[model samples]
Target: MITFQVKDMSCGHCVSVITQAVMAADPQAQVQIDLATHRVSIEPAAADAAALREAIAEAGYTPVPV
Candidate 1:
């Protein structure tokens, strides 16, 4: 599992975009987001931590590894 702290994620749309970005990177990945804490946890089926991080970053957000 990999976790990232996305401070800019504030609403449902943010969650949706992040989830989509993660899924796009690894379709079989499992994603969990805590909007209140600004945390995103992912269980990647094939993608690596670096790839996932880039995916989130490409989605227009700052993903700080936590």
Candidate 2:
């Protein structure tokens, strides 16, 4: 698994959007988000982290100063 810091993530809605974005790039992606700590853990490490990042950006979850 790979862990990403999405410091802006703070609620269930944020989870949903991030999940969708990751899945769009790789349908079988397994995503786990921790709102309390602002961390996102994705499984299947071989997946393209860059694509996932882009998809999240497209979903408007831009990270700032994380």
Candidate 3:
């Protein structure tokens, strides 16, 4: 699983958006968002961290390596 610290994800809506973005990129990916810590954890088929980070950014959030 790859984890990212998404600074802009502050609420439920943000979680949904990030979840959709990650799923759109990798359909089989398992995404978990923790609003308390502002962290997103994804278990994707492949370790495409760059693409994942970009997808998160495109979802209107800031994804920083964690």
Candidate 4:
């Protein structure tokens, strides 16, 4: 699984947005968001950190490498 730290995720709406973005990037991906840690974990078909980061950014959040 690939993990990203999303600094802008602070609520349920943020979780929804992030989840959508990740799913859009990889339809078959399994995404888990931890609001307490501000972390997003993705088990994608493949590891594409850049794509993931871009997706997160497009969703209006900042993704920090973890």
Cα-lDDT of candidate 2: 0.76
In order of appearance, the predictions have TM-scores of: 0.99, 0.81, 0.93, 0.92
Error of 2 at 24 (Å): 0.9
> Which candidate, 1 or 3, has the higher lDDT?
1
- Tens digit per residue, CA lDDT, model 2, 1-66: 667788778789999998988888778888888889888777744567677777777888864323
lDDT of 4: 0.89
For residue 66, what is the lDDT in candidate 4?
A: 87
Top model number, lDDT: 1
Model 1 segments more than 4 A misplaced: none
Output the better candidate (1/2) by lDDT: 1
Q: Could you tell me which 10 consecutive residues in candidate 1 have the lowest summed lDDT?
A: 1-10
How many clashes show up per model? 0, 0, 0, 0
The best-first sequence of candidates by lDDT reads 1, 3, 4, 2
Against the true structure, candidate 1 has what lDDT? 0.99
lDDT of 4 at 17: 90
lDDT of each residue in 1-66, candidate 1, tens digit only:
899999999999999999999999999999999999999999999999999999999999999999
Per residue, candidate 3 scores C-alpha lDDT tens digits across 1-66 of 899998878889899999999988888898988999999999997539899999989988899989
